[model samples]
Target: MSLSKLLTVCVIAISLNSTAAEHSRTIDIDSKVVSNHRATINGERINYSVTSGTQPVWNEEGEPTATLYYNYYKKDKVDDISKRPLLISFNGGPGSASVWMHIAYTGPRILKIDDEGYPMQPYGMKDNPHSVLDVADIVFVNPVKTGYSRILPNKDGKMPSADEQKAQFFGVNADIKYLADWINTFITRNNRSLSPKFLIGESYGTVRVSGLAKELQQAHWWFLNGVVLVSPTDIGIKRDGPVKAANRLPYFAATAWHHKALPTQLQQKDLNEVLAEVEAFTINQYLPALAKGAFISPSEQQEIAQRVAHYSGLSKAFVMRSNLDVSNNAFWKELLRDKGYILGRLDSRYLGIDKKETGDKPDYYPELSAWLHAFTPAINHYLREELNYKTDIQYKMLANVYPWDRSKNNTGEQLREAMAENPYLNVLVQAGYYDGATNYFDAKYTMWQLDPSGKMRDRLSFKGYRSGHMMYLRKEDLKTSNDDLREFIKASLKSQTHSAKY
Candidate 1:
């Protein structure tokens, strides 16, 4: 569907939902399990059923508050459902849908995009050659206010107030608790309680799962076998803090190198070599100088400024003008200012016109700003058409589910806690080198911070891709990442088996 048509449909959907609300019927959710469907992935045929619907979320007093929507694909003919490992997946938006990681990445049918992940002409779905469905049953979940999920209004068919909404499902800890309940409910309802469980989260979803792992175990005694984090962003996305600029330096270096905007010497070397030098400089020189604030000498400051400009694609004067406090957003604008174009925040490979190039930050993120054009519609098509599920509720691809509470929800600490609590639990950290959002080095730093003792370190694995946030959209990265995920699951399952024997 075209953008205009999709918007029209959304208008219709909202009208229909509003009309339906007039009837004031109590929400009684029944899992809408669709019939089995067949797909050929990895050159092999597999049969799976799609369950697309919402689960009514109620308060402790049994008052309906919200409806959490989810999509699931379970492999058919598994001799023992208990032995079949289940992977529950979600994408992080606090307001974004699960579609990014669902139809775009791990689902049996993936949306067809260009070689570099741009929307393809005659956009449609196809069997994912690299889908991990051959190995595990997957559930793609959308939290309240995202995808088909929504907050249930009062008996008068009116939406709840903002504070009431947050009280039910908006804040960090609030989100984890409800999601944990939904997971357990799904497991119990599907009779897969014995299945080894895994979690797959992308971007902010990583933060969600990190805290979720601990919440599941601590609150419900639900232990997860493993976790797969794509473009991990455990720490918050703030960029103006003391060390934040320094933390973002490696990413700037990577983006500059990818765009060939760096100095000739750095550009000529391999990306890893360039990254190694930048990492050393970030830790040894840049960070210390930045830490000095106004105490450092001009000569030393000039030295730092020169090297920062050399590594980053910005001018020395520009770098020094900001007192060496350059951020990822500034780099995005400055690096491509001369070209009258803006580079993408998620992937520097994508370019967009910035209206006029006189700005500190890019006019918009080309990669995600135009996402609604393709991704939103594609997901709506897949859900209503292919899955045989019908819904008139306008799917919330992304909403302003704010003010997003960025409290002391240290999810990295939660991840470490889960690992410590569940010895059998392992983790797979996957990062995209070109992912300007959750840079590779920051992910490394998060993992390093998690494993201070190195004993649980062996269980932690890492993989870096040449793509961006939704790395699997890249054809090669898709295949390679699926292969990696297959191996990781196998190793984790084996590790679980070994731990069982002991």
Candidate 2:
């Protein structure tokens, strides 16, 4: 049935939830509401069932400590269930809800935003024709403290202490452990054990899944077919000091080219051509100069400063003042400082009007604020009204997952290990050229450093988009990215000539 017709048949339920300490309520910890719907995706009709529910995260003693909210979308009319692919997805913030990829990218519903990704009035959702549901089943998972997922209270109505919560669900290792256990349960309950499983994560979610790739294999004995990293983090790859500082040039050039801030010669050329030039200079000249530091001669320093200022759209004086090293923050503020505007941290294409453009960093993230404005309403309405899953609890678009322990993050190496062990496992990375937070260059660097041996290099691939972090927000990328995912899923599921042996 059409979504409108499906919405007419409401199936609301009361579930346990609370946004604050005083507002706690009692309800079923493990609850679900199923709804059937149809939409035209990729020029084909897709009938799918959506299961919106919460699954319990148990402790070692087998006691329920937390419940995770998730939306599982399974396409109907599949002949062989075991051969079908299952795509598990998560968005990053370490604290962010899974709503992003759920509605905006891979799921059947998307926000009612413009082609350029600006929020529109009459906030709602529309059919996502580019969604990958046409090719594979998908589940958007909400980690603890995100979406409606929360730590449960005891039978006596006492919640776990903050320290206890951290120990169980907050840190890097703790998150991977519980979520790996949760995935095992989810797969088993859904009867997808024989299906080809793939994990896709964005931002910090990249770290989560990279670790899970290894943890699931070692801890749960669950092997995956593929992993997708969208706008990935460093994934514990080390690029400190001069290496880190020099990597900023290509991103700087990309952002500058986007705003037409580059010199007429560079601005006139294509973005890729400009980036190629900047990248070569960065490796051959910028990195070496930064390494030499105060030991470098004055002429070389002047030459380096000129090139940095030229590519970064910053003045020579400013580049010299920064000692030939410009932070992303200063670039955001300085690029359009003369124009009296600031660039969005996540997406440089989006313009922000600050009260004063004199600061090193933006007053607020323009891109995030705009996204929250659009996503917050659409997700709530889609869940409660459209999907017919009722709840008094406010669906958090971005939750307070603070004190997020970044102490021990070796997920990059873990991913390498996972790929090395499982010959069936392949990785596909998607990045946006304009994403300043986890820039495309950084994503490429992470991929390059992921498998140092280079034996598994062919199994890894990268795709860059014209937009920023959530590149799918742009209409064009929305289609291309979903296509990339569809191709990757299909390719990974193909029969391999050799077994998984090193």
Candidate 3:
């Protein structure tokens, strides 16, 4: 062969090798940063260690598919590792980060918000004096695309298509499946297999954890001591037509009473007292009236409208025009419309201003904006400055996980099954009366429908707060809710001789 031709072939081989090396370059997915911290919770000093890290999620072929970021807090001095309960916490949104509960509810650090959860200036964090870390070790997890968690490129540096990602991580069932696997891996890695485990989820996290309760037990052979649902979702328990419409009355009454917009009689009564009357009316009169539809006599419909208006702070004429079925957005917009204000969807306690008062809903979520303003800075500062988990990557507080598959959401039944199979598992539901999105009444209704036979009624309990969805954001509720959680955890601890069978 000619010398020039041989040289050309060698150069071509070198170029191909370079291209292959670029494609084969692997990204680091597993890492950790440990730090120690001390905080005074419930008037007692507690020392704890925090492990902030990213754990890899593997595919069926054992290839790393995604990386999940988590912050695990363990009490510094523990006598028995098994005695120390491990609590896995998650927030909702299907795409939302675990930051809400991590910073505001269960974690040792809290955002600097005012008494009623309004954002305070100098956006930062303070020692959460009510955190449950004193009783149980806690781990806050951020699923794919949330927080710093992300899906990685393939070995060939090719990314998974949107469809593939959804099939693996974006749906209700897929979410539970992978999260169950991730949690099992986390437990094994942390050596907490023998410890009594608990799952606490807020908002949509309730759905995630309710499903997790069963998934962990059935698929992973891991049983939990308790499951805490904070501001829970419907959990796949159906509530359509009249049932759904009627359930909104109690929440309306609560929000109206909060805004001082209720009738004089209700305004003068205590919150719980007014709610009792409204709830009774909702179940007895309102639901039947709604179920009757347009077939009912006009006089009877008028009377029902009057009562609904009385409870909802909406005009009788408006309620009548709505055909006695008011939507949440319509109510939020119409409740304070005359006053040139709009009630917040998540927390009606907060007022918002819209471009015009003529819309059916507010232009944006006021409560959410306030939360992001407070939480974004606090989390960014705390995770990097305090916890020392350094990364230039933008911490996604809420990412785009749209095209989210919501089908086959039988999580309520899944939870019921978990309870039936594991007598050790007890469920605690916490909700805020004023949370319009996942109203307290709906949470109660879900609990009632979760077990049709009512066989597990004794194992389920619900707590109502005076605040909004993230009830723990309220100063009073922050302490009270955490106390409630602490009590539930302690009560759920099984005796050494406790049997799995009933």
RMSD for each of the candidates: 7.0, 7.6, 3.8
> Which digits, one per residue and each the tens of the lDDT, describe model 2 over residues 315-362?
999999999999988999889999988889899898888888677888
Error of 1 at 214 (Å): 1.0
Candidate 3, residue 290: CA error in Å?
0.7
Off by over 4 Å in 1: 1-28, 154-159, 235-240, 500-502
The global Cα lDDT (0 to 1) of model 1 is 0.83
What is candidate 3's lDDT per residue for 1-502, written digit by digit as tens? 8999999999999999998876653334999999998999878899899999999999989999999999999998798998899999999998999999999998888999999999989889888888998899999999999999999988898999999999999999999999999999999999999999999999999999999999999999999999999999899998999999999999999999999999898899999999999999999999999999879899999999999999988999999999999999999899899998888889989888999989787887789889898999999999999999988678999999989999999999999999999888999999999999999999999988888898788888999999999998899999999999999998888443677776
Candidate 2: which pairs clash? none
Alpha-carbon TM-score of each model against the true structure: 0.91, 0.94, 0.94
Candidate 3 TM-score, true structure as reference: 0.94
Candidate 2 is scored at a TM of 0.94
Q: Look at candidate 1 and tell me the lDDT of residue 338.
A: 87
Q: How many clashing pairs does model 1 include? A: 1
Residue-wise lDDT of candidate 1 within 1-502, one digit each (tens)? 9999999999999999998886544332544848578988778899889888778777777777787788889888999988898999989876888988788788888887877788866777888877889889999988887887777777677888888777667778788888888888888888988988999888888988988999999988888999888888854433345567787788888888888899898899998898889999998999889989999899999999999999888899999999999877788888978878778988887888877889888877889865566687788888888887776667888877898776877777788888888887889989888778888777877777687888888889889888788888788898988999988988888875456321
Worst 10 residues of 2 by lDDT: 10-19
Q: What is the C-alpha lDDT of each candidate?
A: 0.83, 0.91, 0.92
